[model samples]
Target: MTDQPQVSAEKPSEASADQAAPTPEAEAIAAYLLKHPEFFVEHEELLTTLRIPHQRGDTVSLVERQLKLLRDRNIEMRHRLSQLMDVARDNDRLFDKTRRLMLALIDASSLEEVVIAVEDSLRQEFQVPFVSLILFSEKPLPVGRWVSTEDAQKAIGGLISDEKIVCGVLREHELAFLYGAEQGEHVGSSAVVALTHQGLHGVLAIGSRDPQYYKSSVGTLFLSYIAEVLGRVLPRFTQSSRPVY
Candidate 1:
């Protein structure tokens, strides 16, 4: 007689064990904590006892790590505040200097005084080393550098065409034309502005020894403002004395 096939009790028990395996301890804890963040608030003692691994192979209490993060953020915020304060101070000084220069221009009576006002303020008050104010005319004037319209067009045509401030390093010939050959060679970077109002007046340029100093429009606001004042003031004198094309 064939006996009934006997079922293996071990196989059934093993399958049951595999199916009933619990979630990994660490994963279960993390998931539970994520779902109920208030768990930490209820068990405040864990904050002092929980260890967080540090980069240096040691561990620190969660509370200590939190304090360190707060300290780092405080330092970063302080640095930003300091930078903003520095910029504010600089702008205040610039505004004062600009106010003085505008007053001087208003007080100027003759074309000579006007030229002196521009040159002296830019050199002494503004602390600019290289400055050039070239007037465009059909004939050369006695005061300041005056170039025939043709010569100016040939030299700084690109610079004078734009009403905006032109900044960055300039071509050798352009530099030579604005400043003298010797001085132009020393100008590493410059900002040029075309003096224009009802008509084109001239060009005003300032140069620095540092190549990166005038690389953009960052600091050319004062220069452009000064140029506008000059454009209005200059026409008053030029139209009376020399004709400008």
Candidate 2:
């Protein structure tokens, strides 16, 4: 008879059992905290023990951290509100100036008078350093800085797109065409507003000696509005007769 040896099962050691047990991961803990908002109320002592790092290299309690975040948000909101208020004030002033200019244009009976009114108001009221108006029509207008449509196109056709307002430093050729060579040399930046109504096409050019006076990023709402007003009013002055260039 052959005798078979008996097999015995041994229990796992305490150290091995402890090592095999699953530990809670940081992500799982975070998820649990998010899912159970009331967990903080149950264990409020953790709020005093937990520390968060601040930009100033100081650690703060959870309550203090929350207060800091609220303060930062409040400051940001206040700054944004101040900027909005400033913009509103500026818009109000511009509206008043535009109203006065509109009245002046309406009162002028002749094209020459309208031109004078625009130039004077732009200089005195709007504080524009340099201004020029170029009308494109066959009808003869009072002799001034008026140039033929062909001349104007050759000078600034590429700059203007439909009725869009162009703002930035103008090219040497464009600058010279809008302003005289002597005046152009002094202008560092400019805004050119295109005007079109019926069969009339023209441009109102404003120049400044300061390079930053007119920025490309600046809004052209007021300039476009003025151009629209001019387009409507200036056409009334032009006659059917061909203008002698």
Candidate 3:
């Protein structure tokens, strides 16, 4: 055992230790700064001293970076606010149009007047390009496009099967039936709602040239409401004529 003396393992150098891990003092300072966000306000000189690396590989003072961050946030907020204002203005216009349409529908005396009111309001007031209102009847009516119940079922039975509103790109045949052959070819999307009160009165469908316009039911509330109103009102006029089921 006395032939060889034991040698202790060499300890890591100070430079290696420093490079391996941050000192506790630096970590404590960081933690304290986080806990006291107003620390910079008290020590204004530190703001000029602290630097943040920029995307361009240049360093910017903490104050400049903070100002940039604040400016970016302000711009984003302004953009969001502008969008909200636009939506509000659009809703106001929609409300006014809807009010006018309701009045016209209420004032209508005859079936022809009713048909005229809806078509005119939709085309002129609502600015809808393509509008269709088909009434189902066994016999030809004096006003509006009248399709026999059997024919209506044959053409668009799936659309009028329920009271819920339907929206999206329709098949070529459906588009033709709702908007007509030539006009339907130009229509990219459509929204349809069945008029049902005591019975299935008819179908109300609107079309847009933009394919994405009526892709969903997001903006079809007014269409559905108008259809509901027509359903209830049409029954009053059709009682004598007897609109088929």
Model 3 lDDT per residue over 112-210, tens place = 999999999999989999999998777777889988778888999888888888889999999999999999999999999988887878899999999
- Highest lDDT scorer: 3
Against the true structure, candidate 2 reaches a TM-score of: 0.69
Sliding window of 10 residues with minimal summed lDDT for model 2: 236-245
lDDT by residue for model 2 over 1-245, one digit each (tens)? 79999899999888998775455786688889899977856865555566666455364446675565667778999999999999999999988988888888888788888788888888998888889887776645674456667667777887655667788898998998888888999999998987776544578989899888888738567777778888888777764423222
Q: Give each model a TM-score.
A: 0.76, 0.69, 0.76
* Candidate 3 global Cα RMSD: 11.7
Tell me the lDDT of candidate 3: 0.84
Candidate 1 vs candidate 2, lDDT winner: 1
Candidate 1, pairs of clashing residues: none
Q: Which regions of candidate 1 are displaced past 4 Å?
A: 1-58, 240-245
List residue ranges in candidate 3 displaced over 4 A: 1-59, 240-245
Q: Model 1, residue 202: what's the lDDT?
A: 81
If both were scored by lDDT, which would come out higher, candidate 1 or candidate 3?
Answer: 3
Q: How does each model score on lDDT?
A: 0.83, 0.76, 0.84
lDDT of each residue in 51-70, candidate 1, tens digit only: 66545436554566556666
* Position 70, candidate 1: lDDT: 62
